[model samples]
Target: MTLLRDLPLSALRALAAAARTGGLTRAAEELGVTPGAVGHQLRQLEDRLGVKLVRREGNGIVLTRIAEAALPDIDRGFDALASGLRRLRFERRADTFTIAADPSFSSLWLAPRLGNVRAALGKLDVRIVVSIALDSMLEEGIDLAISYRYSSARDLASADLFTERVIPACAPTLIRNRSDRDGVEMLDRLPLLHIDQTMGDDVYPTWANWFTAAGRKRKNIDHGPRFPLTVLAAQAAVSGMGALLASELVLRQHLDSGQLVEIARDVPALTIKRRLVWPVDGPKARRASAVAMALAAVARAEADGLRSAVS
Candidate 1:
């Protein structure tokens, strides 16, 4: 007999809501229960499972590492359950497909290039959930997702979206003498753009990493004004504020439009992976197949263009 089968789902729901909202009060508000009631259910879940899923940090509750590992699965399960409820409640169209992606990725990359897919699939209702939270899509029944995670749960299917080749890029006007001197040599003269945070995480690439990759290791590698998102950093680079070391895949459209120019095309740097993932079959699985095809088509175009730009 499975031990998980004996677990009360209401307690699980309370725990998932708390994990999602990051607080008991908000989780109670969301679940239509009192804060104390939510806390009670959470304690019940912990006791039943014999694990401390959360710990108090000041007035707010924070997930333990074990909870962090389990929350994604719980979120995904609740998302599918909600989708099933929605399907039962209302009539839906066969052509509609919902996709979830980070706000920065949606704004910088997909928003500009999605027209191609829309034009190709004129019969589909494409819904985009611009969220930094990876679980938002899963919880809301999105058909597909683009995430920067290196890997995911074993049950879902995923494919590589594009090559994440990190290179230095800036506006055309910023590099007047880039041809006169080596691009790597111009690094000390031009400002560097730093991205201190990306999406939900505070960790991202920096000017120091790029310089060390190029064998420079300058002492003053941390010399640029920091931005919160890669999109903002890329835009600052395009505005001539500084050169940004970002993924060539994300910067391909800007590079193609001549809004941004690669400063260190010959330098090889770190690779950041992004993936497109979907379930094998669900309520919206058929439409998801089409959306996946559309995404794969776009991915090919992007990869090909980046190759041409680099070579």
Candidate 2:
């Protein structure tokens, strides 16, 4: 009628140590405790079990007959516990993957397609770190990074994810009555939302840059509410605040959902290369390569879909 929950784990450990080491002093040394403490734990265990578990035999101690009979199973149980702990740690490391990306890409692109990534990765748990700096990859233990900047370092492998494309877009309500004007004129009329120019790799185009690409001149190009992240600017555009020079790749959900509509189809889209990078020498390199392939495939498929839709 003794319940396993009522048994003290310390006492069980002391018993195992004593049985394995053959003496209380040696057991105490193995357990990193005093011999007196080990003896006390054994006494507690014996009292709880209503049995004489150990006996003094000259200068050393010996397990009693009943204790000796139980020692093998006890040793097996301890071994199983240690083995289980090791397996748990190993499985945790095996199943978890860490990736780094910029906040805008992480929020607008990668965050939405994670389910696809998960399916591609099987049971691995993907951890996304919001960062664009490749320098911190080793220090932060990042398994892979999706970044706009590519590195030619000998120790790293890089694969192109996709070229980020940006187009001018805004809520339908913002352009509801402006049907008479062309895309460029409509963009000229609407307030221009801006993502902070200094934030990313200067790849994100500004309203001025978009106008130049369109061969038009507009004043006060920087005269809109500025956001530090592209995702934030996309949200502002969705709220009918202003026309956003939005990343077509990153903010596709908003455009697909009709939360935002492209105002300038004739204007040339701006583009920046985004790539996947990972250490070639690490234990996770193979897994990272597999994940990189999956991510690139997903991006390519989506990009193809977008192109098809646009055409």
Candidate 3:
């Protein structure tokens, strides 16, 4: 007879992640553990069971028959254990919250307001996962999400967060040299910086879009050095590498501080809307509501502050 009490949760989790992700390296990345550690745990589990769970292939791993046979039951057991743990922890801690959001917004906006949340709750932990992929809240164990999307979530309770508004921006020195230049003229003189495609569909208002919106054309829309993210692209523009189209929300502080200056401020703005989403039922809903309230308060405060500063 085998004892279920002898199984380690970490070893079981490693197996499931490896099975789901198709590799140990990917599982390690998602679990925030070393690949060696996950591999070790997998090997330990196989040793305890006296079975070969996986085998090394050419630069990859293949699951053995035993692993396949054992995993479905292991996954079910993990799910049940997770549900019980969540309920117990929720009942005990009662106030800590976790959220999932876009990386840029989480870093640039929400992080600054955590002090406010901490003050309100007395003690709270807000875990934020920043990825472009829209995660399943229940599956991923996230309480709330801030995502850019065209339609509101009817399946989940949701609220409007904010729209993205983009404008051409560059170092103040570049702006000072040609303060009177329009969008087309500025593009002629400056290296038109392009954002690398890593941000997926969310990164828009490209130079092409901006030029089209302005009823002008620029041949270098697809040209110039590409950066991996807005943070890097914006940094390049701030250093006078070239002109950049950045969200007014993200660049407001820079604009206010004179680090980056907008070109053709009168041109029509380009915008994309975003929203807050959460499950409609369960304890997650209460946690989601609390987070939403905090987010709304913070966003409103930021908007008001920026509006006043701009005025």
Best-matching candidate per lDDT:
2
By summed lDDT, the worst window of 10 consecutive residues in model 1 runs over 197-206
lDDT for each residue of candidate 2 in 1-311, tens digit (9 for 90 to 100) = 35577758799899888877889999999999999999999998888889999998888888898998988887788799888987786666666788888787787678888877775566678888666567667656678988777687888889999877778888888775555123577877888888875322566567787888888998887798998778888899899898888678757889889898877776667887888998887778888888898899998898799789999
Model 3 off-target regions past 4 Å? Answer: 1-96, 119-124, 176-180, 197-203, 305-311
TM-score of each: 0.58, 0.61, 0.66
Q: Which portions of model 1 miss their true places by more than 4 Å?
A: 1-96, 107-109, 112-124, 131-137, 172-183, 200-204, 253-259, 301-311
Q: Model 1, 205: alpha-carbon shift in Å?
A: 3.7
As for candidate 2, its clashing pairs are none
51-88: candidate 3 lDDT, tens digit per residue? 89888777667789878898889889988988899888
C-alpha lDDT of residue 140 in model 2: 60
lDDT of 1 by residue, 148-167 (tens): 75335554567777757777
Summing lDDT over every window of 10 consecutive residues in candidate 3, give the lowest-scoring window. Answer: 196-205
Q: Give the deviation of candidate 1 from the true structure as CA RMSD.
A: 11.2
> How does residue 178 of candidate 3 score in lDDT?
53
